[model samples]
Target: MSTVAQPDLAVLSSPWTLGPLHLSNRVVMGSMHTGLEVRDDGGAAMAAFYRERAAGGVACIVTGGIAVSDEARGGPDFAVFGADGADERFRVAVDAVHDEGGTVLAQLFHAGRYALVQGVTDRHGRPQRAVAPSALPWAAARGVVPEELTGDEVRSTIEDFAAAARSARDIGFDGVEIMASEGYLVNQFQSPLTNHREDEWGGTPERRRRFAVEVVRAVRAAVPDLAVTIRLSGADLMPGSTTDDEVDALVRDLLPLGLDGVSVGIGWHESRTPTVQASVPHGAWVSYAERIARVVRTSDHPDVRVIASNRMTDLRDGETVLRDGLVDAVALARPFLADPDIVARSLGGRFDLVNTCIGCNQACLDRSIVGAPVSCLVNPRAARELAFPARPTRRALRVDVVGGGPAGLAAAVDAARRGHTVTLWEADASLGGQFALAAAIPGKEDYAATVRAAVAELADRGATVHLGRRAAVADLAGSDAVLLALGVVPRPLDVPGADLPHVVSYEQALREGVPAGTVAIVGGGGIGVDTAAFLVESPDEVVRAAEFAERWDVDVARDVLGDVPQRLPAADRVTRPGPEVTVLRRAGKIGQGIGITSRWVAVGRLRDAGVHLVAGVRAYLRIEPGTLWILDEAGVERAVPADHVVVCAGQERAPGAEETGPDGLVANLRAAGVPVAVVGGARDASGVDAVRATSEALEAVRRLAP
Candidate 1:
């Protein structure tokens, strides 16, 4: 196997030209909807978000897809370019990026069928119907059929694109990128499955390509001096959708029409392919970009560069692809959310200190999908960056943080950084509490990265960490403040036979191997789902290799001959034929806390592993011998044969931990004349995760010292 070296910082940070615009680095911040824009002001929160990334050393920043026309918008929160007072609202954002030596581009978008089906409203608060080349119902759009655009409507939409580009240019944006990918209006017209129109705007490849080509031509003409780029789906991945050959032809036809560059966005909203999930191998889509780059390389307009996107997490992977001539620039969206200064840190050779994105979409894309501001699970201060500045404490004081989990680690680090003498104690031999168990889950080793980062941060910030040492409340008597981040313990099952030898907690199942047989997992929450994934063995390497080759349409023989690594490491890959697992949930849904962005992937994996999911079980009658009795929602009793039962019902607060209210731990501690704070799962039985733990810890430390 060929070993890829560490990224050459000099090469990565070198200045590169994208058509007429010069970038200080080859890194482009991929545009992602943050849901941070102030509806009244153009992009107040959006500007702050981008400015932070620009200051962190990103070469160019692409603003989230700005709605070009009110009729084509997703929601009131979406940035509008041609709307009233849009220029004034957008000027501040453009200036903010420019001030930080980063070129900003406005991404013009029309969500089309998605917007209508999503019930997206216009400025007047009326539901905006989606328009497309043909009246097709996208599965994601539920049952809503998009209104097929008349030829006149199509032409006007093209004008809307041009006008939006002009507005962006007028607002002092460096460029404008037309959103032609991801099942949007433009992509709808380009796809054979979506655009079944027999008119000039569809049918033949040239006709289907007309809408995109026209939009690019019109936008380029409207904003002659501004750089124009189109975000294209290298392959839509949808059934009977636009193929690579079609995309190549489309690119060839569009490049000659004054296109400056193309940003490759892989897959559509409805595609079966996994594009940007954590389970996806790093640089999985680099091959798609390479194909597009090769096409651009031989095109009549070779000046147009290919920007590789979709799961480009780290500079090492980005550098490898760039070195291999796959892409001219690597575009990252989530990584910047995890570490805004990722580029600067890489350039300075502080790679270890760089908090890499774990691709857990829980906070970032998941929140955005629900119309909330995008944040990071690992980095608490993502969209709310300004809110978390670690200012000096009012005075130096001794601080004791109980538990060395994410919460304790964050509090200790932040408190120490604020000039407090901080000590963190964990009862276990290591820092990570539940996170360690989380890391042990198959395909979830990235959680370990969060623990590693926290540990490093604690050490760097001069926090004393004590492992295998249990600190009592009495031990914190002399401390000026105490933070109890004592994590959660498994909630025991209340039914009969819960104490059987085969009945184990989810933690035990994750930490230790379960007996190989029919295993039943109780609770379909995140832990239950994860435990099921952990217990089930993945398909063997030979099976996985065949599946991969089939998924990507690669030749297995050629792949083997090329020395491609087909077998996954024992630590990372899943195994099959290991255990017959069934997940039982009292609730109607499974993986409730799992984010929508990743829940499907987890469920899909479970399905592929042949794990049975049974929901709406009203009662667990009992467990006897090798059988478990459960009552269904309809009051029917069913006997499920199980060799072992794993309980993942949920977590409860640790013993003696108080609530988060005024009369909680802090109040009681203060009543005893000792300053105190509380954070993590110890503070609340519900609403506990890494993001919450970390953010609450930072806030608690700041409030304690303030």
Candidate 2:
């Protein structure tokens, strides 16, 4: 394998100092909740999770939200300061990172109204009511209203932040970061939409900013020797919330409060705009950080570092921003989850070996939103680092991984990395399988990058990949173990005229180009919605950062001093019009199987693109030369006119098994006394997704690997 050309990352590689803390580079591992803190192993799991990333090459690691008090805790999994063994957990994690020559900062957090979950308890083991600046019901929390914090309670919360910071210093943490962004307790007080208080905590802009100001003052005074930073919302994105000027003012006030750094966070949790989802372009939120950086640069504390964060998965992009001198550093959260060694790989010019975060949010953010243990879709060993240790095998064996999809690639790499000789087979001319088709969708270019990374990793691990070869039972019989990741075949449309030339499979439409005329997409699942989004855009418009910003009306080109525009001005371009696309579903929601975090963004993109969506279809009746017929839920037959009928209904197991049905391949291999493991869509296509496929592949290798 040839070494890839390296981009100049001089600025990103430069050492920097933040107050009392010194970092090796400008890259920081931003905080993310992995639900490993509450584990019974006294933070062993969480320590391993941090140590792996720290060793991978992050200059500093920001620990996930550590609640200051019982009322501030987001949920039961949130590590609280006074909780039993909390200091021990902090000490373990800090010591582990320090052992790897890495610095870690504890992020003091308060969930505010977001902690409406039932499990949150107080010191006396009684259910604690979620507290906020005012007694308002969060829109997403149904009708449950948070109790307004009394003046005394609010002051106590300030003391809580101070105590947490003091505890972090005692635990050997390098620093402490106050989480004031993302609609948390401090952010809630800053926004009028949530803070209806008439006291000094609200009423006016300066008063509204008082809560955060006092918290900063308290925390800084408590740990004067520690490197203290605050994560501030650059733009809340919520209507009737803190204006950009007000947020800037808050930053100005906080800078004078003896802060070391400011990490800019974008959007509120309830904001309609997409912040971290895949559809959001890489570096879309950097401008907000730039805005804050400008303020910090002009302030008395010009030495304070400002970190650009959100939607920054690529280090090259981070280097670009750093080179431009817009911000002092770049903090990436989910990308580290996807590839712990993202910095090392990119620095070595082995970008192809870096598993890029596709921004799918399937496993990480989606699970974190529901308090589930957060892992990665591409790398399932993220939080399970200790369990899936990559120790070289004492006795390496021959391993055959059939099908070059994500599952097969993962298995091949895992086996090869374990010192086993691995051989991978793919019937297609190239690898990627369905991911290649997915990459054709404008916003999903990273899906192709994922495949490239997997392929590169396989080669780097000394695994042999045979393209355009279907390994039969005979071909695999001699292997010590055969891992079947044969993937899935598109479930055929079983209606009349289904074989018509105008009726194309979803794969065909994605792999090849759809017709220029109208398109009626059958099945409003993830694939169907993706196809609709693809067909509704011009071929040349690949939905990169600039184009996405334009389409979403984010006024990125506005003058820095001007009040940030809520929407961008229209720009006319001469280009071919897209096809008229309509997505149909029999039942359930469109993009049904997509992760909760990304489904809305996908559906929103379709709607914004003028794609028609039809649900409650009783049945797909038939396909004509230029139309598709469907039975509506109203018991009426509907004719959807279209030049192309794309079927994305779903998929079934690949026809790898012969006489013994779907299990024939496994049965045959077992009959020949060969070890066999079936995974991915080959094992079961029903509700099969990338997350499940890669996760199953790891489990199979864990069991099969010696």
List TM-scores for all candidates, in order: 0.91, 0.95
Candidate 1 TM-score versus the reference: 0.91
* lDDT by residue (tens digit), candidate 1, 350-413: 6666777878888887777667767787777688755665457778999888888777776776
Kindly give the stretch of ten consecutive residues in candidate 2 with the minimal lDDT sum: 569-578
Q: After superposition, how far is residue 624 of candidate 2 from its true place, in Å?
A: 1.5
Model 1: lDDT equals: 0.78
Give the Cα error of residue 664 in candidate 1, in Å: 9.4
Q: How do the residues 109-175 of candidate 2 rate in per-residue lDDT, one tens digit apiece?
A: 9999988557557767899778999988776665668999999999999999999999999989999
Best by lDDT: 2
Candidate with the greatest TM-score versus the true structure: 2
Q: Rate the local accuracy (lDDT) of all candidates.
A: 0.78, 0.84
Candidate 1's displacement at residue 49, Å, is 1.5
217 in model 1: Cα distance from truth in Å? 0.9
